[model samples]
Target: MKIDIDYTPENKAVIHSYMRNVAQGNTAGAAADAAADAAKLYDAGSATVQVNSVVKAESEAGIDLKAGEVKVSTENQTTTNVSTYYKVPNDGKLEQL
Candidate 1:
């Protein structure tokens, strides 16, 4: 799984600060910061969850992949829109493009 995030410097600073606060055991502060950042990013349309495939096994073990678009679940938050992408490689396995 991979996610690409592109945001303004202020948002990036907020994320960095949130991580630091979490690492420093500031749970209350981190939680508030994370919630705020999540809302801001959601409104700004600056986050993307891009997934290629779901790999189930190693290639040596006859790799099997459930190839399809990924669905993101944001509980308690309504999504205005979502873009789904479908892709399948010729090998029938998940390969990074």
Candidate 2:
């Protein structure tokens, strides 16, 4: 049997936030809460603003992984280049990518 899974950008962002909090020694509930908060904030803003915020927060928090850092490999494509990467701090400000 073949199983399919749907992972949306929002879902991935939530998971990423949770994992990051957990890695920083936050409890599961705390991590979930933080992720939820981040998601809500992101959803309230425009796409450009949202992306900028995430990146800034990650950078200020010393997070190694920023949004759009990972590249998806295709069967036929050997490589991919991310056009831009944003670094937003947790201070709730939007920075350029």
Candidate 3:
């Protein structure tokens, strides 16, 4: 459930690399290089993933059933004849008591 990550000292290395790249300029130059590093969709289908790309979470929302209703079939049988007492249907079929 954790979506965003907190910044740590490790981020400094990445920031430094970006600054160095900007100063030295990328080999491919600005226009020839990718517009931006496309964020990998967490769990999205990898049908279009590059050879070295790894995919995680997808764009679709997960299914939730907390508010859903489930149905079960039940039947009530007559129990007036106490001596000939029977019990509720074990196989879900109504039978006379």
Candidate 4:
């Protein structure tokens, strides 16, 4: 489904807050990660998204991938660029894949 988005001041404030928390390395809990992830998803553009597939990869860095695993795939209909992300169950964050 295509959802219309209105970039209001309040929304901007929330996104900014999430970015600040992420920059400060305060992603110890799932809230921070989820917020940051939402910001990133919004950045991806195009409200319509599809889960192409799930990916499982070995953890090279101990910082993002605490559980050493991820699951999820998305494709941007407008750009047709598939961006893969790693799902961290420990903190419920979608990291880079």
lDDT measured at residue 62 in model 1 versus the true structure, 0 to 100 = 35
Better of 2 and 3 by TM-score: 2
Off by over 4 Å in 1: 1-3, 49-97
Error of 3 at 23 (Å): 0.8
**Which candidate leads the pack in lDDT?**
4
In the order shown, the candidates' Cα RMSDs to the true structure are 18.0, 21.0, 27.5, 17.2
All candidates: TM-score? 0.32, 0.24, 0.23, 0.30
* TM-score of predicted structure 2: 0.24
What tens digits encode model 1's per-residue C-alpha lDDT throughout 1-97? 2323455664677557646665777666467877776554444333333443342432222334587555443334233333443223112233333
Instruction: Provide the overall lDDT of each model, using Cα atoms, as 2-decimal numbers.
Output: 0.46, 0.45, 0.34, 0.49
What stretches of model 2 exceed 4 Å from their correct place? 1-25, 48-77, 81-97
Q: Is candidate 3 or candidate 4 better by lDDT?
A: 4
Q: By TM-score, how accurate is candidate 4?
A: 0.30
Q: What is the lDDT of residue 43 in candidate 2?
A: 45
Where does candidate 1 clash, by residue pair? none
Native-structure RMSD, model 3: 27.5
Q: How far out, in Å, is residue 26 in model 3?
A: 2.1
Overall local distance difference test of candidate 4: 0.49
